[model samples]
Target: MKLILVVVLTTAIAAIGITLSLILSQRQAARDRALSIISGNKLQDATGKPSDKNDPNKRRAALARKLKESEQEEKDDKKKKEKGKSTMRELIQQAGFDFPVSYYYILSIVSAAAFTIGAFSLGFPRIVIAMISIIGFFGFPRLVLFLLTKRRQKKFLEDFADALEAMMRLLKAGMPMNEAVKMCAKEFEGPIGEEMSRIYELQKIGTPLGEAAVLVAKRMPIPEMRMFATGLLIQQQTGSSLSDILGNLAKVIRSRFQLKRKVKALSAEAKSSAGIIAAMPPLVALGLNTFNPGYIDIIFETRSGHIGLACFGLWMFTGMVIMWKMSNFKV
Candidate 1:
């Protein structure tokens, strides 16, 4: 029995040592392979590749990699477009416009018809009226939507800081987030209130705070709101001091709002100048028609005159756009 026990012990020891050695060797091999790759010494075919098959395989691999990259890029671009669409939809909602996505197309058709008719009635040639119609069809809706949405977004941003402050106070009082949002929805007015109402509905539907944050960020698409949502989500996930986090964020947002006001004050003159310049051409034409009655009648009476007016209008619009972009401050 003693001899049998000794034999068994010896065999167990041998097995353990073999397994340990194998594990150590494998770890060492892995480290070596990693080091080799890092040092730009990746292992190559040991059999000195069958040249023809090797080249073909390498080419195929490269092509596959490029195809994968292009596909990934396409997916990223598509995601960007979807993100833009979402923000644009939200902007329209904020502006109290119930227009469907198809509204732009319908408006474009109407605008084209209207511009064609108006220009033709003014004695413009068919070709000139057609060009103006095309421009109006493409541009009028975009311009109107842009101006309305920008104004609404500005109003929302102004009021949004107040909402954040209200929320911070409620949170500090130990009110639950959904309850705080509900209060804000009830007490606040305008775009911010409507947005909070949506949040309350989302919360009532049992959406997780993290996912809700992402949703709100997508809808609002503003830096302050996004920061607030991100803070809420992180606090939810990591169990942080919600009140303190929100309080600090609210302070920061208010400070940003003040800075924006100061910037607006400083840039007010430039913005006014840009606006006046943009308005000058139309205003001058209106004044000339009112005062002189037949001044620039040739512009509407002859084909050459029509061509000149169209060219001048195009250049004036381009200049207006450039001035507006330059005068505008993103913040």
Candidate 2:
């Protein structure tokens, strides 16, 4: 009877605690909602205020000024949207693989399926089959995608200087900034042009220029594009000459590109030496295995062999990372 009473008491205490927790959570949620509503109202009040006037001539002048400001604001907005659209397109292209998260899930499923099949078909050890599946389905695909994305981005950066020069020439010819961008989109081929074309279209369809530029900057993941977008946004806000600003930007970009090339050239020998040194160990191990099978088999035929292999892989990876860091230069 006493034990039953204790159990009942425990259950009641837990239920009370749970109920209190739920009540507190509900109160917190309500408070958050109220705060959100208050903030939203403040934003609407600031952005949606109405213009007021008392006299006819004054009203006319006020209306004209308001209209002009609205038009300029609209143009700025269109440019921003165009920039955004272009950026998203560039990111997709440069990454070389769409839907990385989805790809990982797919690869996981594929690896599991391959592992199951290998275990059943060849009578391989479960661990070996698992390793094979992991390497073939997940590891190899990830490696390939990484390499491809890197190469694609490199190509885009290499081409960026020329594209900027072309746009600068068009700007010098007294073409409007938007028109010059469109001309570049039409003239250049590849990722840069493709991104520019998207921006051009977005600007044409009434997207805000500032918003478009922000979008483009976000998508490209390039420092130069980000810098350009920021400069353009500031210029638009301050009513600066777009052509002269872009010309100076073009010069800066060109100089940076040249500097990057020089850095790469200077580091090429060190990079090459690192690669050769990294390869030597593996090649020497292979030669030893080929020349003396029994001697090599002793190390690789036991659990200790697996441990050694894992250690070797770790060492190699660490070395490669260090070498890459040494070689990499930012401008």
Local distance difference test values of all predictions, in order? 0.68, 0.64
Candidate topping TM-score:
2
TM-score, one value per model: 0.60, 0.61
Error of 2 at 150 (Å): 2.6
Clashes of 1: 0
lDDT at 20, model 1:
64
Which regions of candidate 1 deviate over 4 angstroms? 1-91, 273-326
Model 2: lDDT equals 0.64
Per-residue lDDT over 162-265 for candidate 2, one digit per residue giving the tens place of the 0 to 100 score = 77777778877887778988988888777778778878888999876666776665456566775576556545544445665566667777777798899999
Candidate with top lDDT is: 1
Q: Write the per-residue lDDT of candidate 1 for residues 1-331, one digit (tens) a residue.
A: 5664575556556655655665566656644542332233112233654344334445345434533543574477479777775544555564557677677678789998998889989999888988999888977766777787667668888887678778888987889988988999999887788778888888889997656765765555565765676556545544545666666776776776797788878878988988888788889999999999999899999876876676576556556555654555444
Report the error of model 1 at residue 147, Å: 1.9
